[model samples]
Target: MSMTLFCYLMMYCSGIVSLCLARKHIMLSLLSLEFIILSLFCIFSIIVTIMISESYMMLMFLTFSVCEGVVGLSILVMMIRSHGNDHLSSINLFLC
Candidate 1:
């Protein structure tokens, strides 16, 4: 279990790096964000289970994360429709 927690932590770190490096590609950045959120969910689940043994909060967090992902996807779709591309450079220029 400890090993699993360590792996999740590593994944979370890598996800952050990926998000930073893939800033130009909106889809890739969003995928990295998803990875980060999932790793966080795992870490929280393990900690909460060990400390409080209640999963209600975890479930609520999962629901919120799902809603967040949906909102992100919607925004991505709108960007694609308006810009016809998913690159940050294009978006920056469009916004300006």
Candidate 2:
């Protein structure tokens, strides 16, 4: 409805598209996922602020983002340490 909301929507879509297209690249894909998640968190915070005019929700979302970032980086580090190549296909066997 608002310009900010529309911008967030477009960014969210672009992040999804980038992630889907960057299959063999581990770093790019993981970062793209983070981008999507960050955008979603931003959108939710914005909506919450508009509804309640509160900023604590933004801090809560950011804390969750920090946790997700830590986990994603840890997984990537392990993937690199084991395979020496950070591609998704190389990590799938570990999952299965």
Candidate 3:
């Protein structure tokens, strides 16, 4: 159940992809963050569950994920409002 090296590589690759793709869409920016967070949480939980059965690190990860998701969504809203639009047709200098 533990995360292996392969899982780490996969998560890294996906995070990069998410970063690239999310640049083109506001909604996707939020979604991609969620994807990255989920992958991180999953990987940590897998490794913890296998190596330290009694550790509650996974629970902390889950809590952090929720908080992050909330904060990320709020940021998305702020970004859209500040930009005065939701479309990401132009490269956002602030986000960059």
Which candidate wins on TM-score? 1
lDDT of each: 0.93, 0.86, 0.74
lDDT of 2 by residue, 16-93 (tens): 999999989778988898999888987997888778887887888788888988898898888889889887676666
List, residue by residue over 29-59, the lDDT tens digit for candidate 3.
7787777777777677667776787757777
- Residue-level lDDT of model 1, residues 1-96, one tens digit each, is 989999999999999999999988889999999999999999999999899977999999999999989999999999999999988788665555
> How much is 85 displaced in model 3, in angstroms?
2.3
Question: What lDDT does candidate 1 reach at residue 62?
Answer: 99
Residue-level error in angstroms, candidate 3, position 74? 1.2
| Candidate that would win on lDDT | 1
TM-score head-to-head 2 vs 3, winner: 2
lDDT of 3 at 86: 64
Deviation (Å) of 69 in candidate 1: 0.3
TM-scores, all candidates, are 0.92, 0.84, 0.68
Q: What range of 10 consecutive residues in model 3 has the weakest lDDT sum?
A: 1-10
| Candidate 2 lDDT score at position 44 | 92
**Stretches of candidate 3 exceeding 4 Å from the true structure:** 1-12, 88-96
Which 10 consecutive residues of model 1 have the lowest summed lDDT?
Answer: 87-96
